[model samples]
Target: GAGVSQSPSNKVTEKGKDVELRCDPISGHTALYWYRQSLGQGLEFLIYFQGNSAPDKSGLPSDRFSAERTGGSVSTLTIQRTQQEDSAVYLCASSFMPQGSGNTIYFGEGSWLTVV
Candidate 1:
C-alpha cells in the first residue's frame, strides 16, 4: 500500500468480547507502531516493532492487550475481554526508520472500537 492501511475502520462490540485490529505498513518501512486515543485524549503509545528486533510492548495497558507483527510488514492488535474503558481509536503508523532516527512516520485513519 502507498500508505499505512488499517482495517475495520469502525467497530462496535459488546463488553467482554475480543477484538482484533489490523495494520499494513507502507512498503519497505521497517518500523510500525500502534497507539490508542480515548475520547478527547491524545495518542497513547501501545506497541512498536522495528525490523526483527524484540517488539517494544512496554506501552500495553494490561495483559488483555497484545500485538504482533508478521513478516515485519503487517501487524495486529488484540484486546481480550474488552471493557467499556477500552473504547477508543486505535491508530497504526509506520516509518522508514525509528522515530529517534528522525524519519517520517505515516499514520492510518485508525480503527474506532466502541465497547458497549
Candidate 2:
C-alpha cells in the first residue's frame, strides 16, 4: 500500500483559529509519528503512536496540541487557539517496525500551516 499521507497540504489562518491536520498511515504499518518543522529549522518530534495508544506524548509542544489514532490506521493532530509561532509544516510518518529496530520509517509530504 501507499506510505503516510497528510491532508490540507497548506493552511493559513488568523491567530486564535484552531486547525486539525489528518494523517493516513500505511496499511499495517502500526507505528505512527508526528513531527513539526519550521522555516529553516529541523524537524521536531511531536508524538508517536504505537498501535492505538500513545505512550510517549511528552513530545507535544503544548497543551493546545493533541492527537489521537483510531483503529491503528488514522491519526489527527489539532492545535487550539493557534498562535503565529504555531506556524510550521506538520509531518506524519509510519514504520512497519517499532523504533530502534531496523525498519525504515516513511514520511509524508508535510502539511503547511501558517497562523497570521
Candidate 3:
C-alpha cells in the first residue's frame, strides 16, 4: 500500500447514477481490528450502512452500505447497485483498535464486484 495521503480527500458524484460499496468494521473485546487487504488504490471510503451493532459504527455510514455481525464472529458488507468503479477490491476497517495497538484495522478479501 502507498499509505495515507495529506491532500484533501475528494467526494465527487455524478447525476442520477447509483453506486455501491461494502466494509466490515472490527469486533472485539478490546476494540481492535486487522485489515488483511492492501489499499494499492487509495484512501477512498464507503457508501452507506445497515446493521444493528457494529463493534465500530464510525467506519460505516447509514446511507450507502450496510453491515452486520453474525454468530458472534465475522461480519458482512453489502452494497446495492455497485458502480463500475466499485469493481476494485473491497476494504473493511475498524476504528475500534486504538493507535499503536498490535490489532489494527482489518480488510476483507477483495469484494471483486462485477458491474455487469
Candidate 4:
C-alpha cells in the first residue's frame, strides 16, 4: 500500500460485542503504531511494533485491547467485550526506521468505532 490503510472506516457495535480493526502499512516501513482518539481528546498511544523486536504494549488501555503485527506489514487490533467508553477513532501509522529527526510518519484515515 502507498499509505497506511485501515479497514472498516466506520463501525457501530453493540455493547459487549467484540471488534477487530486491521491496518496495512506502507511498504518498507519498519515501524507501525496504533493509537486511539476519543472525542475532543488527544491521541492515546496503544501499541507499537518496530522491526523484528518485541512490541511495545505499555500504552494499551486494558486487558481487553490487544494488537499484533504479522510479517512486519499488516497489523490487527482486537477489542473484547466492548463498552461505550471504548468508542473512539483508531488510527494506524507507519514510518521508516529512525523515527526521530526528519522522519515522516504516515497515518491512515482511521477506523471509527462507536460502541453503543
Candidate 5:
C-alpha cells in the first residue's frame, strides 16, 4: 500500500500571497491529520478528520490557515495572505484510528514553505 505523500516538497512565496499544499494519504486509512513544525519547534496539530466525525481544528494558528478533506482521503491546506511566520514544514499523516498518546504516526517527508 502506498504511504502518505505531499507535493512541492518545497515552496517559496512572498508575503500576502496565498498557497495551497496537497496531501495523499494511504488507502484504507480512516484517520487523517495535518501538523506543522516550525524551526526548533514541536509538531503542532492543525486539523484532523476521521470518518464521519467533525474535524478538529483547534491547532490552526490563524484565520489565514484552513484545510479540508474530500472523500475521506485526500486533503489540502490553504493559507491565505501568507506571512513569513508561516514558513515551516507541513506534514501529513494517516492511521487506522485516532492515535493514543504513545501511538506511532507515519509522516510524509513534509512540504517546506518559505515566505520571503
Candidate 6:
C-alpha cells in the first residue's frame, strides 16, 4: 500500500506562468483532497473528490486554480496563471472514506511552489 505522493517536491515559476502539480493517492482509497498551506499559515482546502460524487471545489482560491481526479485515484492541480500569492505548499491526502473526522487525513510531504 503506497502512501500519498506528490511530484517535483518543489516548483519555481514566474508570475503569469502555469504550473501543474500531481498527486498519487494510496491504493484502495476512495477519497482524495487537495490543500494549500502558505508560510506561517493554516491549511486551506482546495478541492476534493470522493467516489463517484462530483468534486467539491469551493475551497479553490480562484478561477485560476483547477483540478481533476482521474480513475478515482490520481489527481492534478493546475494553476492557469501563477502569481506570487499562489506560492505555497500543495498537499494531497486520501482516506478510506470520503471525509475524515478528528484529523485522520494522511497527508503527503507536499509540493512546495515558489512564484518569483
Candidate 2 structure quality by residue, lDDT tens digits, 32-105: 99999999999999999999999999999899999999999999999999999999999999999787897899
Candidate 1's residue-wise lDDT over 14-100, tens digit each? 999999999999999999999999999999999899964546889999999988888979998999999999999999999999999
- Greater TM-score among 2 and 3 belongs to 2
- lDDT tens readout by residue for model 6, 1-116: 46899997999999999999999988888888999999999999988889634468899989999888889888889998899999899999998886645435789999999999
* Residue ranges of candidate 4 with Cα displaced over 4 Å: 52-54
- Give TM per candidate: 0.96, 0.97, 0.43, 0.94, 0.91, 0.92
Predicted candidate 5 versus true structure: per-residue lDDT over 16-82, tens digit per residue: 9999999888887788899999999999999887863436889899999988888888888999999
Return the top candidate by TM-score.
2
Over the stretch 1-116, how does candidate 4's per-residue lDDT look in tens digits?
77899999999999999999999999999998899999999999888899644458899989999888889888999999999999999999999864675579899999999999
Candidate 6 residue runs with Cα over 4 Å from true position:
100-103
The pairs that clash in candidate 2 are none
- Runs in model 3 deviating more than 4 A are 1-40, 45-52, 55-62, 93-100, 104-108
lDDT of 5 at 6: 94
- Candidate 1 vs 4: which has more TM-score: 1
**TM-score between model 2 and native:** 0.97
Q: For model 4, which pairs clash?
A: none
Q: Record all residue pairs in model 1 with backbone atoms less than 3 Å apart, i.e. clashing.
A: none
The worst-scoring run of ten residues by lDDT in candidate 4 lies at: 47-56
Clashes in predicted model 4: 0
For candidate 3, lDDT tens digit of each residue in 6-101?
Answer: 111212334334443333344442232222222465644542222334444454434455655444334555544445444444544444344456
